[model samples]
Target: MVNDVLAIHNGNYSWNIAFERGLQDLELDDYALLLTSLHEVHIKVGEDDRSKWKSGRDGIYSVCTYLRSILGSTESSFPWKMTLTVDNLHRKGFYVTEWCYMCKRDGETNDHLFLHCEGVRWLWNTILTSQHMDWVMPRRMEDVLRAWSRKFRDKDSGLVWNLFPGCIVWCVWRERNIRCFEDQAKTTEQIREWFYMTLYT
Candidate 1:
């Protein structure tokens, strides 16, 4: 799974410390909201899978495929940006509408990629007890993010596990941009590798 590969989003030094420090500012309701919406079960893995940790992590990568997005109602996936959909709205307005690059659903936007990408289905499975997450994919990214946050909210709870999801999402979007404008592309492996590089070091 991606978490096993590029496991941390490290662009911002002290990011973990900062995030933890800010936790105190949250009210009990914020914590409750966070937990209620957290989809922690989406990452459950079989006990047998413990052995394939590294392999699972590496499989989350796309080593040879070019990062490309199919044409849609929007002009291009260049200006595309995905942010926390805390209240059921993307950071920007949906111009024409889009579908997830990996899922090929009716609507391919930030939420789809975050919560429903089959590309990351294996990764999500690591959190769910069922050993498969895509089967019962959440309706939106906000739910996934909050669920992830709540599940790993504890300091001793491996909350850093969130880095994998956040980094993959960011890297995928970055690759889409590079492909659209620079006419450049990277294999999924390269993207996964770069995700680790850009996010951590």
Candidate 2:
């Protein structure tokens, strides 16, 4: 009966008839009229499914909402960390040299620290391989988020996939700080283990 209500893959059944039958099968006669009210809903065929963010008028997640979600009294978000990188710090009077604290092979930028550096690339590739995903790393943050959201369709996989970019951003930035301030560096295995432990529990 519950499966009847969730028969979204029933291509053989006409949409309205299937929905009405599903309601009757579930003994939801009380909701028959209410459910029928959704008949006017427009579903564009041959289009990718898009889930909207209820909080945003545009049906897309806004930066304000993202910031609110990840921010706490003591913690900032991944984007905030990227904004305050060593390169940006130099501009703001922190007087730090502009080199990726992670790899130190190239100048630091948010993209380099989060996505492009060889060490970061190795870390991301290892994680993706573990999940049996073969995604190409995007050069920009927005592209990465778009790819993750589009590719992972199942709830559990999508949730984990959605968190990976932000987690990697935060972890990589933290590792950069440890190298610069705490005089410590971590191997790729250590970083991978830390990410998995943080993600699962």
Candidate 3:
């Protein structure tokens, strides 16, 4: 819902913005609230859509649950936007300058930055292997996202691609930002290690 950041449900999320922001920056806890109770806010939304956020007995948790559902991650106790690879360079008043720093030919769109960048392609392979998950890196982020969903639709070989995607997306974006702002350099292994560290936390 709105890139995983829906507006407040009865002002609860608004009140917790600071705490949520802190957890996101630190890569800490992600909360999952059980939403329940509707119809009260209704008289408009039909019964089918109305009761989704209301589950438990009294449904006093409706507002928080509604907000969490909008976040699209019941497993995740924390709310996070999908990893954004696009640089803010567009805001600096230049269009042609969006080309990849490592691959001058391609624009630094989400697909290029996260998928086809020469350096990143190598890193992605390493990341998959280290995670002990069999994954094929697509030529573009869109392709990768599509394949990822299809691959993880069911469990196989004692692996769960579902659990790892969130961490993978998180780590890739972190590395991109590191190079962009910190002037740091890292190898494929280093990036994988970072992902592990973040995941365990």
What lDDT score goes with residue 86 in model 1?
23
TM-score head-to-head 1 vs 3, winner: 3
TM-score of each: 0.39, 0.57, 0.45
The Cα local distance difference test for each model comes to 0.48, 0.70, 0.54
Worst 10 residues of 1 by lDDT: 10-19
Distance from true position, residue 121, model 3, in Å?
1.1
**Candidate 1 similarity to native, TM-score:** 0.39
Model 2 bad stretches (over 4 Å)? 1-82, 151-153
TM-score, cand. 2 vs. native: 0.57
Highest-TM-score candidate: 2
CA shift of 4, model 1, Å: 60
lDDT measured at residue 152 in model 2 versus the true structure, 0 to 100: 50
Shift in Å, residue 182, candidate 1: 2.4
lDDT of 2 by residue, 1-201 (tens): 423343354343224335424444567765666567555555554457678876667779988766655553323234544378767677677876768888888888777888899878887887789788798777776667656654556888778877777778768878888898999998888988887787777
Report the error of model 1 at residue 14, Å: 49
Query: How many pairs of residues collide in model 1?
Result: 21
Better of 2 and 3 by lDDT: 2
Candidate 3 minimal-lDDT segment of 10 residues = 31-40
